[model samples]
Target: MKEQSSRKGFAKFTTLDIVLMAMLAAANAVMTVYLSQVNQALNGLGGPIATSTITGLYMIYGLLAYYIIRKPGTALITYGIGAVVQSFMGSAYGILSCFAAAACYLIIAEAVFAAFRYKNWSLPVMMFTGGAMVPVWFFFAAQMFGYTKWGTGVLLVALCVRIMSGILLCGLLTKLLGDALSRSGLLRRFAVSRAVES
Candidate 1:
């Protein structure tokens, strides 16, 4: 029963989290609407680009959710929920694209977190969690949408863009969130768990 309860908790995000994610998705819509042309232009110029890295909204969403619910399925639920919320709201991405994005995030994040047994809430692990956003970022926005279908060179460039965004923006945001959560004492047990790992 306790385990079931824990699972439920992992699957459930608070009302605050929901509101935050919805806002994020709405912003994504606005950004995409306004900046997609620039993004296309940059990709044309750079041979693949990290345009989505501009806002760093999704990174914050993932990091904040992980910070609050440091348990298995939490990352997946929050990411998936955020995508759904974004699609349901007036966000830029269509419902199909949102589904694709949510699936990529859910699968990759679960794989990484499961490998770590879902307890590595340290800075690095959290960073990796944020890093996982990269593939989905491209998978949904670029590949599924036919951007990567341009050519092999374009595909490789897209991959580079994803990695660059993950490292520079997502990773940094995750570390910042972890630090803030540590300061807030919301992640005390996670701190000890990280210490044990080291």
Candidate 2:
């Protein structure tokens, strides 16, 4: 029999895993509403840069899910579900855009994780994945909102701010939260907890 600690069965999801994903999806739904309000509040005062800064918080759902699940495609499945939940909750950009954005984000994150062979969840790796969404976001925004008109300089500046936000909020904050949860023994069944034990 394959040892429980082995990654051989990591590709499969258990009923408990499905239930956890659903709960995370629901949490993401709440975050979407909260983020919309935060975006609205920041929009007039801070423009795209300010708004995107807060977007790092959006990465939390995927990060937390991935940390716990520690499975290939976990980010894709969790965040894709998050987008659907957000769409049903009513996104101004519509359901399709949310889905597309989630898909793009997943691609970036998966690439980063894959680069490490999904064995190293080091800070640098996490930070790289956290910021990976910026390029994808820039392309998607240009297509959706004619953001190209803003000029490359302005866009680049906004992207930098977003990357920093991702590093701090998504990468650092997720690590902090994961550590706290692991320490509390609340995540004892998760891979992260096992990693901590080892």
Candidate 3:
């Protein structure tokens, strides 16, 4: 009989990890609501780019949580918590839609991390994951807003814009934020903290 391979990396979740996940999830919810409000305010006046520019910011919490926790299921848990918080805060899309979007992001993020065996925390891999999230993001948005019939050219353009935004906001900006937090000594126990320290 073949022996079962242990999920050694996912063996446990410390109290500290749980606390950090909760805090990060709440932070993401607040930031997402605030940014969405800003986007709505400037949307029509400033053009579509105004809202799209911040699309990547939506992935920030998930990225940070994954980096800090370095464990499987972190994305799902954090994003799920954030979705609930956003719904309660009166998000324009309602609770279900918020959760749906968060789920989509989680699916993509989790798959990407799994592909790398959760070992590649390099900036390039993070950026790739960020960019990869655009397709899923666009899919849910299209369904929610009834944009499923958008022409190919238009959809392509929109996807490209989102990918660009993801790289900038989720990828580079996330790294910057992580670096700052790591430097503050708050993330000393996390793997990402060591990367920053070195």
- Which candidate leads the pack in TM-score? 2
Model 2's TM-score against the true structure: 0.89
lDDT tens digits by residue: candidate 3, 1-198: 123324544456677887887898788778877887888976777545456777888888888888777788888888888888888877876788788888888999899999999888888988888888778868878878766576776667767888898988887777778778889998898877877777
TM-score-best of 2 and 3: 2
* Stretches of model 1 off by over 4 angstroms after superposition: 1-47, 50-59, 136-143, 184-198
Q: Provide the TM-score for each candidate, comma-separated.
A: 0.67, 0.89, 0.88
Better of 1 and 3 by lDDT: 3
Best by lDDT: 3
What C-alpha lDDT, on a 0 to 100 scale, does residue 2 get in candidate 3? 25
Screening candidate 3 with a backbone cut-off below 3 angstroms (N, C-alpha, C), the clashing residue pairs are none
Q: Write the per-residue lDDT of candidate 2 for residues 1-198, one digit (tens) a residue.
A: 568645565648766666777788779788777888888889788887778788678777787777777778787788888888888888866777788878877888777777788899767777777777667866886779777787888888888888898888888787888878888998888888988888
Ordered from best to worst lDDT, the candidate numbers read 3, 2, 1
RMSD of 3: 2.6
